[model samples]
Target: MAPCPGRVGPGGAELLPGTALAILAGALLLAWPAFLNGYPLVFIDTVSYLAQTIVPEMPWDKAPAYGPFLHAFHWRMTLWGSLAAQVALLSWMLWLTQRGARGGVTPAAHLLLCAAMVALTSLPWFAATLMPDVLSGVAALAVFLLGCARPRLSRIEAVAVLLVGVFAVAAHLSHLIIAAAVVALVVVLERRVGSALRAAAAPALAILVLLGANLAGHGRAVLSPNGAIFLLARLQADGPAAATLRERCPDAGWYLCAFADRLPMDSDEFLWDPASPVSRDADGHPRFMGSVALVPEAQAIIAATLADRPFAVLRAMAGNALAQLALPQVGDTLPDTHLALSARRMVRDGFPPRELAAFDAGLQMRGLLPEVAAPFLRPHLPVLIAAVPLALLGLARGGREQRALVLAALVAIGANAAATGALSKPHHRYEARIIWLLPLAAMLALAPRRGRDPGLA
Candidate 1:
């Protein structure tokens, strides 16, 4: 019996075998866990999640500042359960991509897209983490997919758009930067400021909801400008001023201190100064030990640093992003390799108890396949560098245009690489999540068929 042409809905069409395969592949990857290890898998963000779980009432510092939605979820779920939430989020991304493909793509093409996405192993690993990275990634993908799927969407479709926008804001503050860029693109393409403003309602509403929730839950706006200023201040301060800033703004300084603070002085020498103007707690420890309260004066310093060293900042960010992409793991432990193994042994055997404990906990894990995988990944570096050109080509190809998809792919890759190079360790797993999109973009670029343009539809 020939299948009655499987139609989805009023405008929906039949599914292709390739699309099914892609979805199945994604599902299988999502379900696989045998090779996964719990201890090493838990990155710094996972530690933040653990802290949140243990102390539900603790206000979020900058580290895991995902707000009440994730916090609420973490409070209710165990570590494994939280990991499941990440999986669910990954599934959401897959589903959104499928739905977004719509008229512009055949079932087979859609499936191929999904398969390509699944091929990016980093996506699943990021999904497995307890951090907001998965949520932000899903949100970013959703925003792009939704934009591609419906050019002149109905009210109901707008609701979905609104949800994506809201999720973007609530997921992670940094994602808002990407979302803003996307909105600007839509504005330029649509050529209607009013329409762009209307489209932006979703994200705006999301921001409002986040603020309202923060106020309701914590009795203050979670990421108030003042709080940000204070945090920045502490980040810029040096020596005695920095110490005073830390003492005054413990919450804002907590995450910064946890991750930053590379000074060579002993904790006792710096932290236990009796004559210092900074205030101390009951134990004679600095009151702002864990806080990251931003101060106006410190903000001025950060601003000056940026202004004075803009190029350096850019270079550092770029370098950090590259480093992060090359690094094996984002966690706070060194990779288990011959060199790292020897170093770990030396640290364990020779270092003092306190120093050894710190070194073991602070060192980042290296990648298992960096030497082999990095070269294969390097070809995709062009995709990031030439994203604008690739996107233009997608646009030129017209109907069922893969330009937006390609753009999303590039954004994911370029942003990941650029960001990792700038801020975090370079790890292949981190790059793996978005790297497959590069080849997919190239494939779309090479394909001969001119399908229905997503923009036109």
Candidate 2:
């Protein structure tokens, strides 16, 4: 999109024609870890998303949208193409969001912003990642831009923002909830009900995408075939499900009556560990996301827990939500743990030999990513510590545009913590995915306003 008329910057600088070079440089900087790794970063969930290519059935654990997203960006050859596309999209969001600054952020200043994030935040790690984490931030930006920066955008940019927002929300279930919250805030604060509805339409569009994909691929029109399992896992991990199970074991007539004593395991272990009752077969093998009967049982358990012990469920969820809020820190963005192993094995099994070879050759697969990532991870907390207060100040005193962006970031971060922590598990990665927004919005809020555009028309 070209720069808006009457929107002035230092020396009356503009963008589109100007920001192209900066966007390119920023994209590379955003994906710096991948450049070092010689391959795009992979996560535990990367394989499941990649599996969408070959698997006919829609997975119960994750949304069906991201596998196709990776496919669309993968260029059919190397993942660097996907990484490039992801980071470029993120860079554009950063520039466009920053462009909402009072006079507008100059390309040089925008570049400085991206550089600061690469050095001090978790932006680079996710930007280069093959998973849907980068899209989470992109979705937040899309919500802010579509909801707050729409008038400044051309019809094309608006449509582009909507499409990007769809995939960003569709990439994960938690994203959908985060988007809904941001859209609501935009409506309430900006008073642009129409704009907020348009923003809300992104999640609607994302839902349609999942329905169409499921109908075409699996001959079913369901969204998230076993979505309740995530809730069940969360409740079980949080201690409510076990209490429910203990209360009504044999009479409940559920398959889980076989294992009521093993009350509350960690959500990850319940979902992935072979010993977990949710997934453990009679033969001792850990099945993928448990048996065919698991979803219904999971749903029943979740329902029973909420109905019987609503306070316990709510308290546990509240605790998990609070835990997640405090855990947006960047820890293990690039892993050397079992998650790394999962990605490695899945890539080897699901992808072509060449793709697997390149994956295996990456810094993570070589056991070097954690060490390489440590230095970059160190400064993130300190930067976030500074950014939170700046963002708060921006929300309190900055102009409407600044307030909207900062508030959107805060709402998305809070919503993400609540959703992922309460519905899935409280992990740093869940909140870390969207935490970069704080610094980005804070910088834009504090940016200088040189020109005459006071606010939107």
Candidate 3:
């Protein structure tokens, strides 16, 4: 084939025009609101972005510090001009992926891969919204592109890898698991501890710096005891069974009781039963109950629970993971006039009061697509459900060469699920951005050549 346009220097790979086309397509989707009121998409993205910006800086007195880099990015992105920065970062990622994937057995295949990435990642909602999720996606793509460019590390390529590591770390601390997975995979494939260490060094340092800053500024590390105590307090007061507990343990710290109640249950199950177990205190009037409050005591309880009910914990974790992967609603932030009208009509027709109320509320909140799209999209649920497994299969077939990339993606997704699953209302969107890996992995699977295959060029 004739040399693709925008080919780099002799040894460097050339960029494909397809990449530009994909980016343009995404840009067009993002710009839809200029003509049509893509309010839902815009609204969802805005809320998520706003949450990232406002929630983190709520003063140490309000909420515990979590995902510091995500919060920082939100703060900085807005201050430095929001939408423009988002577009620039996305464009840079597209360019990087295209350039990095050049010369990797098939240029056209790589270009097509880029197109697939655009298609999968073109969630118009996220494109318009200024959230760390977009940055996280870019960081992930950078890592993947760099890994694909392996076996030859130019000075620039080496720098890119390190920068990606740092960016990934700073983009989301949840990225730590993914980063570690990638590094481990690289080490296993290349058998070069030095390269693996180098790739991970930047992110590792970035994490430490973030932790140091948190400690210096807020006097607490991420997930520090004080933070946990705060979360426990929230869980107790605003949580299920708060009323019952308040009546019993008027003077007792509900945080400990809430922790005890939730310790045995995953988030999903906890949502079902918001009330805690009640017991009598020394005064005997059915006081709110909890285990000992000492750190060692809590640790002992956790250890005992794990030891006695390992299977249950594993089952809860598995179920929570599945729930996190499934998209609950298509466009959560937008209003669907269609659903709202339907809900209103149903109410007029004397539908069950509670059911109609739920429908009305859902219509008002999520709009029609997510509310009504289910029936139409039900058949596709199988495909969505199979994503994680297919990805694992791709990893197995990808051999040692690509194992690192696969493992890194897996670790990131897994960690996110684990962490979020422990909290209340584990929504799919929390980890939705990572869904880009599904299509990316599928592209890798369908690629014409296996880099490690002995028969390949």
> TM-scores across all candidates?
0.59, 0.90, 0.58
Give me the candidate number with maximum lDDT.
2
Sort all candidates by TM-score, best to worst.
2, 1, 3
Backbone clashes, candidate 3? 5
Q: Write the per-residue lDDT of candidate 3 for residues 245-356, one digit (tens) a residue.
A: 4343435443335444334333333322325332233333443222213333334334444555556556655665667756533344345434334324423343345534
Q: Clashes in model 2: which pairs?
A: none
lDDT of 1 by residue, 365-429 (tens): 34442343334334344544454465567657723425555666656556656543343334555
8: Cα error in model 1, Å: 10
In Å, residue 38's CA in model 3 sits off its true spot by: 4.8
* Candidate 3 residue pairs that clash: 7-14, 40-334, 240-274, 336-367, 336-368
Kindly give the number of clashing pairs for every candidate. 50, 0, 5
| Candidate 1, superposed: residue stretches over 4 Å from native | 1-25, 31-35, 38-41, 50-54, 63-81, 98-112, 151-158, 193-195, 214-287, 293-297, 303-401, 411-457
TM-score of 3: 0.58
> What tens digits encode model 2's per-residue C-alpha lDDT throughout 116-219?
88998888888888888877777878888777766556566678788989989888877888888888887786665677687788988988987887677657
**lDDT at 158, model 3:** 49
lDDT of each: 0.46, 0.77, 0.44
